[model samples]
Target: MRGGVELTDCPAQVSADFGGDTVADTADTRTPAQIEADIERRRAVLAETLDEIGVRVHPKTIMGDAKARVVSNVDHTLGRAYVRVNGVVSEVKGQFVDAEGSPRLERVVPVAVLLVGVVGLLAVGSRRRGGSARRRR
Candidate 1:
């Protein structure tokens, strides 16, 4: 193709066979009015393409698309987190429950005692610190 014109075998051979008549001479069969009409049609198509590109690259359109994508991602992340948390809660609940879904007092009492021991240690540590500070002052 040269200057947007495709040189098919018929047209190329015609130019070579007709020696003096160049491709341009044969291709210039369209009248001035027809050429102008073609130009106008091409310009309209180009203008529409440019307008579409402009809309796609516009700041508001870009920002809106980005915001929508972020929202979708955040929603997906939160949904996954919620499912994981629910699964963990169910697993923990199962651990604290028996085969019949009754609370396992044996496991519960031990965990309760461990939590109380941790709290008691924290209270004792804080009291010791406070007492040492008073003595230092």
Candidate 2:
């Protein structure tokens, strides 16, 4: 019964302003049916919003999101590692090969000799072990 107008007389007369809160608008010309329809529409929107929130909070949805994040991070880290290793390989290749793609014989020859010597040593060591086992038998 505000200002002699009963609250039931005009439901549209009561309106809420954004931020400013509730502000009565006596000039609102919307009929009861329109107001009812609007309320129903808002209710449906709210129900959909709640359903979406429910899905987002579900355990399976949360775990899936977490797994996606982990996989993305792992991929990013592996990509960085690959780039670093590639750079290292390029530097090593540069050391053993000239800009014109010719092998630096001075560097390559020494490394090749060292590898061959190591392989020969391994082969001799294995033969010695085999001989010792045969002697014991």
Where does model 2 exceed 4 Å of error?
1-30, 134-137
**Residue 65 in model 1: lDDT:** 100
Candidate 1 residue-wise lDDT at 99:
81
lDDT of every model, 2 decimals: 0.81, 0.86
Give Cα distance to truth, residue 103, candidate 2, Å: 0.4
Residue by residue across 22-126, what tens digits does model 1's lDDT show?
A: 544364566678668877987999999999999999999999999999999999999999999999999999999988999999899999999999999999999
TM-score (all chains, Cα) for each model: 0.67, 0.74
RMSD of 1: 5.8
How high a TM-score does candidate 2 get? Answer: 0.74
